[model samples]
Each structure stands twice: as C-alpha cells, then as structure tokens.
Target: MSDWKTLFHKDQFRFIDHTNSIEPVTALDAFAVDDALALSVEKGASPTTMRIWTHDQTVVLGIPDARLPFIKEGVSWLNQQGYQAVVRNSGGLAVVLDKGVMNITLLFADGNKIGIHEGYQMMVGFIQELFADYTDQIKAFEVKGSYCPGDYDLSIDGKKFAGISQRRVKNGVAVQIYLSIEADNQARAKLIESFYKLGLQGEKSKFAYPTVEPNTMEALATLLNKPLTIDFVKNRIREKLTDLTKELQQNDLTAIEKEMYQKRKQQMIVRNKKALGDLFHE
Candidate 1:
C-alpha cells in the first residue's frame, strides 16, 4: 500500500465543504463541480483539493448502465421510488446516493504520473487513515454482489461500506469515493438490485451487470458499531487533512472554476438527456 502521505504531502491544501451548501446542489451538479475542480488543479489555478459533498435521493449510473435493454423503464422505476436517475461521466455502474452517503473527491494535478491502481490505492489509504481510530480492519477488495463493485471497495470483515472511482481530466485526477456513513445500506443495495432486474428483465447484454446481494453491503456506523454522524466524519477528515498538510484553506470555487463548471454542467445535461431520453428532466 502506498503511503497516503506520498500523495497528500503538500504545502497547501484546499478544502471545499459542499455537504451543506446554502444552495441546493444535485448529484449532476456535483459531478460538474468535480470536473471544474480538476481543470482548475490541472491549470495550477488551485492546489490539491479535498471536496466533501452529499446529495439527496439519487441513483448515479455509468455509461454502460444507460445501455441496459429496458433502461427507460428502469429509470422510470427509480423516479417512482423518489430517486432521480442520472448517468455519471465517470467510470462505474449504478450507485445509490442519499443524505446518509458522504462523498469525498481528492483532486490533484499530474495525474499522468499516477497509474490507475496507484490513484485508487491513494484513496484506500486515505480512507483507512480517516477511520484509523475506530478500526484498523478496513480492507480494500471487491465485495461481490455490491453495486459498483471494484477492487478498491472499502470494507470491514466482509461487508462493503464504500467504493472508490477515478476520473481524470487532462493532467488532473479526481479520485472519488462514496461512503455509506449512516443509512440503510441494504436498502440502497436492494434498490440497485431491483433497478438491474427491471433494466435487464432477464435479457442478455454485452455489459455484465452486478448481481447485487443486499447483505454484502453495510454502513460505516453499523460496521463500527458507533453513533457516527456525517458531521463527525467531516471533522475527522478535516483533522486528518490538517495533519497531512502545512496549510489547510477552505474556500468556494474561483471565477475560472465557475466558468468551467457552467460548461461542464451543460455537458452533463446533454449527456443525461442522451442517456435518459424522454425520462430526462431538469
């Protein structure tokens, strides 16, 4: 495992907290924000950044998910369940995001220097450090039957509590992870299972969809058996970041980043429309 300090050691680090933004921000906007931040970091307009964000009921799908045989029906089903469906511009299968899920994005420059596995290891290492006080049992390995299953899935014992994915924009990389902080992890997994069932309808597709088993997933609070809140987790992230960097600065997007955000957001709107067709709506 690569030492997280290798990736995190910096003179200055920017921390952006969008977990409770004054204005409403959806998962779609969150993806765009990450893209903007990636561009800013690549351009040296910003330092290494750690962004904490959360979204309400939403199911973010990967490009291949949009190709499900009965995707239109699957998306409609998600909407009926009060969960908005949107296709993400990143790599991954369908993932459930809600108030209880906390997302962290580590954006940094010179992504070309890092291999895909290395990038993922950085996130795995950082997450392990974040909860080091709670448990040293966090393992990074694919949790079969979990949504968005990956080799870098963060888990305790055997149940998965988090999944990491990466998106590289030019020379910048945004390594993102969604942590099931405090929620019904099984419920979220079951939702994805049903979505796949409806989308596939037992039909075969070129892409292999996951066989989701609700029991294979869990939340961090449950795994740790602790009364963990999102705020509590956020404080831990701040403390760990402060200890890793010389200076920690909290601020909003810059003017250039705002401009890039609008452009990236428009691209996302177009992508979602193309994927969801008539089902797509603002």
Candidate 2:
C-alpha cells in the first residue's frame, strides 16, 4: 500500500446518502460542502462524511480543457446533444456527467504530515477493499480510450468504470471521484470524443488529450457481469462505511454548512461562467 495520509486516521467514519436524486449543481458547491464537512470533522462536530451526489446531462470539464482551440464549437456541440457544459476547478480533462453516474466525495482533515499522493492512495485503497469480495483485479491504470482517463482510473480489463480527482482547502481535503455506476457508456464516450474534436479543431495544443475510442468504456453492470444498479453501489458503500468505523450516522447539512453551501453556491455560478469565458474568449 502507498503511504496513505495519516492526518485523518482518527476521524470518525460518516455517510450521507442522496440516492437517485437529480442535482443540477456545480463542482464549486461540491468543493464547498467538502470543506465544511472536513472542518466539522476537524472540530469533532461530526464524523468523516461520505457524500454522494448525482447530476443529469451535464459536462464537467477540467481547467486545461477550457483552453481548447475551439472550445466554443465543442460546447455548442454538447448543447446540441442536450448536455450542459461547465468547467470544474480540478484536474483531469472532459467527462460527461449524468443521472446514471455516482459521485463520492470523501471529506477529511489531513494534518500537517499528509502529502498529495498519500491522500489519493487512501481512497484508492478504500475502493479496492470495498470491492474485495467481488474481485481483486481492479487496478489503477490510465484507460486509453476512456473519458477522463487518469493514473487512478479504475477499470476492469482495461475498460474504465471510474475516475478520481482531488481538491484541498485549508488543511481539509476532498478526494472526489465519479463512478459510471449505470449508464450508456458508449453515448457518454461519444459525447466527449465529439467535444474533443470540436474543441481541438485539428489544431495544436500544449496539453495532449486522449484520442477517445468510445467502445473501450463500459458500465459497472456490464463489467461485473451482473445486474448492478446505483442502489447496489450505494449499499456497498454503506457496508464499507459500517466496517471502517465504530459508528455511522444518517444526517443532513448543519446550520453552518447550509450557510456556507449557499455562499459557495453563488461562487459556483461565477466559477462556471468564468471558466467558460476563459475558454471561449470573444
């Protein structure tokens, strides 16, 4: 195992479930919620929360993704395909987000001793362990034809089912990742590949993106050879949460967190526009 972040070993194990809810939210709000929950954990007000959120027909792009030569054309293509496009202040390139995807945001406070790789390693370990009963062949490798391919992309036999990204704020870290739990993986890949073609426009760019091949990506159901649903993944997460901690709580946002969510939500609106404008500068 890699050197996992030690700053959060003592934090409580927590879980929050928003199962099958359609939330048309920004990544900024997600980051803010992560920060607040992490602070709450640091203060011992709550357990280390595992938050799950879902969005429908939205395209979340990375910062570098915004700089594509023909981003406007790419975005226009997405809108025509009925997908909302927004920029996420995080790593990775373009990814198609929708109702069928399950996003898990793990919030915790890592003390001074934590490094970036260690933080990511912790989540990687958790996912592998959670699915240990099913199989141990889940490896971290860049899925060449998958949308949002990364070093931590989780796949079964080279077909990616999930991608992980991280954000750090004030000693609190939000290791966020999205699992294509259930969806039309082919359609999702085609959408992103089109976006890349339109955005890149056969022009040279500083950052090299994957030449996406839609056939190479798949859903958890198809990969697992079973009728896997979001409910199954949710339950699996709950099962893992129970085993990792002594106590698990089912709860809602606190007063402070509510206020922060609203404030940071407005910031999200600004971020979305700023990101688009930066990419599609007139």
Which candidate should be chosen as best, given lDDT against the real structure?
Answer: 1
lDDT (10s digit) by residue, model 2, range 159-244: 88889998776676678888887867888998888889888988988898779999889877788777777788889888777766
Off by over 4 Å in 2: 1-11, 21-28, 42-44, 278-282
Best by TM-score: 1
The residue-by-residue lDDT of candidate 1 on 91-196, one tens digit each, is: 9999999989999999989888878888888888889888888899999998998999999999999999999999999989999999999979999999999999
Q: For model 2, what is the alpha-carbon lDDT of residue 124?
A: 80
Model 1 whole-model lDDT (C-alpha atoms): 0.92
* Model 2: number of backbone collisions: 0
TM-score of every candidate relative to the true structure: 0.98, 0.89
lDDT of 2 at 2: 49
How far off is residue 156 in model 1, in Å?
Answer: 0.6
What is the Å distance of residue 186 in model 1 from its true position? 0.3
Taking every candidate in turn, the Cα RMSD to the unseen true structure, in Å, is 1.1, 3.0
Clash pairs (backbone) in predicted model 2:
none
